[model samples]
Target: MSDQTGSAGVVLKYTVSPDDFTRAGEASSKVKNILKQMGISPDVIRKVSIAMYEGEINMVIHAHGGEITVTITPQEVLMELKDVGPGIEDVEKAMKAGYSTAPEQVRALGFGAGMGLPNMQGCTDEMKVETELGVGTTITMSVHMEDK
Candidate 1:
């Protein structure tokens, strides 16, 4: 497989729209395509794609809107999603499975089953979330190809 070598990494950025559930997965879809074009393995691509997609959906549902930046290198793929939403108050509780602040309408849409964060963790090599009350949240996720 021809993965990015040396300094030949690629960077991509996407803007997420608020309350736009229909377009929630668009950013992740683009990222997945780019990874494929770079010849990254399907497994790695899948992990990164799923994790980032979940993050994107969360941002749209919870945050007003956000920006997602993805960086690809020979060793790893990294994604950072930043949003200016009501920050997660209890990150520890939020990380737990079946924990979510999504409204009933969102639940009716078949989402907000509280698996977004859990799914993200399961799909990535490493994930970190930072937030402050009334400020915003920024999530950094990385998938290391070397681990394969």
Candidate 2:
């Protein structure tokens, strides 16, 4: 793989629209394609892609949309998603594997299985979630790359 043995850092940014199921995965797809082009190992690419997609979907469904920024380097890939919606009330409960607060409409759409944060945590090397009740939430995640 041409994993850019000594390349400089690359940064990618995307805006996720609220409740836009039609376009939900666009940003994550773009990132996955870019990672493939960069020759990132498939394993790392899969982890980053899954984690970021989950975060993106969460923003679309819960956060009234948000912004995602991805920074890639030889050592790791870092993702940050920020949103300005009604913040999560209980982060501890939200981290549970099947706990979800999504409304029935969203569930009818088959979008909210309450697995987003859990899947993200499982896929990333490191993850963080910061939120305030009336303010917003920001999630940051990273995936470490294998030695080239």
lDDT tens readout by residue for model 2, 5-115 = 335588888889887888988999999999999899999999998999888888888888988888898889999999998999999999998899999998998868889
Query: Over the full model, what C-alpha lDDT does candidate 1 score relative to the true structure?
Result: 0.88
For candidate 1, the TM-score is 0.92
- Which ten-residue region of model 1 has the weakest summed lDDT? 1-10
Candidate 2: where is the Cα deviation over 4 Å?
A: 1-8
lDDT of 2: 0.89
Cα TM-score per model = 0.92, 0.92
Question: Tens digits of per-residue lDDT for model 1 on 1-148?
Answer: 1233346577778899999999889998988988898789988998998899899989989997799888898889998999989999999988899998999998987789889998999998899999998999999999998555
Error of 1 at 37 (Å): 1.2
Off by over 4 Å in 1: 1-8, 146-148
Q: Largest lDDT belongs to which candidate?
A: 2
